[model samples]
Target: MTPPPGWYRDPKAPHLERWWDGTAWTEHRRTPEVTAPVPVAGASGRAKAVAVTTAAVVLVAAIVTGAVVLGQGDEEGAEIETAPTYYTQAPTTEPPSPTPTQSEPSADDPAVVTDELNGITLPLLDGWVRPKYVAEDDVVMTTDGTYDCPADGGVCRHGLVMSRTVTSNDERSPEALAKEDIKEAAESAYDRDTIGRRPYGGMESHEVVKSGPVAVAGRAGWFVRWRVTTAEGPGGYVQSTVFPSRVGTESPVCVRYVFDAGADGPPLADMDRITKGIRSVDDPDGGGGVGSSVGPGEG
Candidate 1:
């Protein structure tokens, strides 16, 4: 059964009066009544004065007690206001975002070199040195492909060899010269092949394993390659490209990119990259004057 909301005697302390705030017993307590002191006729004036002072003290204490009881009644059924509790979040700690590291250029990347004399630029691989002796008309020598090794007892190391030659025009088509170069490779053994008018540097030039027409230094020219085998021995391979001067009717400019096929030379793709990157002074002004000509190996 539900109990009615009213004051009742405290069950825990029967002798003391406690306020029942409908739901529970409160801390309010009723104290016994305090009587005010009365003055007595003491025969002496001093005694009467002392009695009056005692009465005044008792009255003041009663007033203070009454105020405390009123304060308790006002606070009844009211929530006690305590200091608000706060919880601070721990400082967020996160691993620093990994800084993306960039990869360094490969050491095997070829060094770029330009011949200021003829304004020809290209990439040269490591260990390939410039030849000490160069012709007056020659712009640069890519050094000898064969490296002399005394430990091996002779020119045992063989690789790619490249050179540039500037000369007057021979007045011959690249395709015709390409065929002629193959024939003249060796009288004993000669074979001629042709790839007609392949695109090179926004232009078309005849091409073959033997030879082709190419552009270098802003002039059209023929590139010829020779592979011959005679009864004597392997005649080796030679690749030569000749370009006529764009500025005048002077001699043609020739550049040779050659290597012995049997000597474990650079791959054909690498060769194509080097060749396509060739640039002359008259070429466009970009990529350090290196040719941006798209070729067989280009993407």
Candidate 2:
């Protein structure tokens, strides 16, 4: 038979009563009720108030307990809405090592070469081979490569030269001397007739690339750069500088570099250092002031 919708003695626990809503047992439960407290004589009001307050507190506690029990009971029979969580670890990776690259030669670390005969010292391009001083001429250093002129058909050895002379009583400046040399070279090898239009040697053409004032041996000087034609290739020419001695004794000095027309020549910056480093010294031993000078022809 169906249970009535009211509180009934619990079959599982004899000391407690549970709610039966016709077909199902509810979460609500209660213990057997004890006899009510009787008011003492002349204190009925206080006693009744105390009894009412205790009942109210018990009722609230029962309601909270029922709610908790209800939640637990439902959890046992109901399907949970939460999904099962899963995690996957990612693979650790590292960046590739940087590729190795070649480092450029430092510009500040210069090469030094000296002319012992003229008592002159100058900086040279790094890796420059000291020349053999093959002739009485002013060759101090030379390149390893030799040029077979495509047009002229002979080897034009390329190198650096140092020329020095003590100035006499002439008051003319170094700039004037360099200008005079240029004029002389133009008139001697290059014809004054056709002049600026014709190509020379194997060079495609020539140009007065640069001209400026420079200082050498603590005295005023001039710097000149000339680009000339090679035989069906690049042109080569002489770069000369004129420096008047600072001792005031009128000593004119010159340092000239003759570069063969080619792509393999030392860069302009190195040439500039070479020229700027030229200074007069009192020693023919190729002194260590500029750096230890290698014995003649020693690189």
Candidate 3:
């Protein structure tokens, strides 16, 4: 009888195994085929062990890849967070306001007047010179240059007269000049031979009066009067103080003149004319004259 065409083995229990197909057994085996014992019970356990080892290797590989991806994500996030941002703001402003103007004096001002003396002309009689006298130093003298009244009138009514010297360049300010003149007048008492010096003859009292704001030589000046007691003489004593209109290192010069009040009479009436004629040369728009050009230097 013929056997099946697929692989077949001998049915008899033998140490050798043989393959047969259809009607014939193959003679291909040069050596006998050895058969292993059948492992009936442990076959499933071996298959399970192999499956567990393969699963463990796959899990380890997946874990390593997930760790690398997570590390990359963290690095990228840090870089983004550290970057800088840009921004801006607005500008400020301010507001505005107005301005004002100024004014000056006019020709109609009443204090103005004019005079001429020794070929010098000036505006006179504003709030300029003050009248006062110094009682010390040299005796001053005067002759009227011109007057509102005639010279023959023994009364000597309306002209002004005075005497003084430019003592020192140190006397610059008006106050300093005044004080120096006064000190000089007091010392003049020692010079008895001088014209206004007379011994006081037991007179009970003395007096002095001053007037000014006169213009002389284009500048402001003052007038002064003094009445003093005589140590030995008879009539009331009188003296005059005249200051130069221009101020200088040697200027605004002071003059002291002793007069016979008995001869020139009281000086009040004449003082009015002197004060009225006083004037100031307007200061030049830029600056004025030779004095302005000259700077201070040793005398």
Which candidate should be chosen as best, given lDDT against the real structure? 2
**Candidates in descending lDDT order:** 2, 1, 3
lDDT of each: 0.43, 0.55, 0.35
- Ranked by lDDT, the better of candidates 1 and 3 is 1
Per-residue lDDT over 1-299 for candidate 2, one digit per residue giving the tens place of the 0 to 100 score: 34346665554565676776766667788986665765656767877898877765654333211111223337467532221111132323598999999743232324665555455667666646656534324456666555553443444455445455534436567787776565434332222212232233423445798898986756678967777654355546667688765333556666666665456655556567777666565433423245445343343
For candidate 1, the per-residue lDDT at 298 reads 20
Mind giving the per-residue lDDT tens digits that candidate 3 earns over 1-299? 23344332232322333445445455432234334434445558777666665555553333211001123446456321111111122222355554554523243333322221111122223222212232232211123322221211212111123333454675545544554454344334312323443343233445555533444445445544455544443333333344554433324545444433444433444444543343334344311221111011201
State residue 20's C-alpha deviation in candidate 2, in Å.
88
Q: What are the models' TM-scores?
A: 0.40, 0.47, 0.32
Superior by TM-score: candidate 2 or candidate 3: 2
Candidate with the larger TM-score of 1 and 2: 2
Q: How many pairs of residues collide in each model?
A: 6, 11, 28
Q: Per TM-score, what order, best first? A: 2, 1, 3
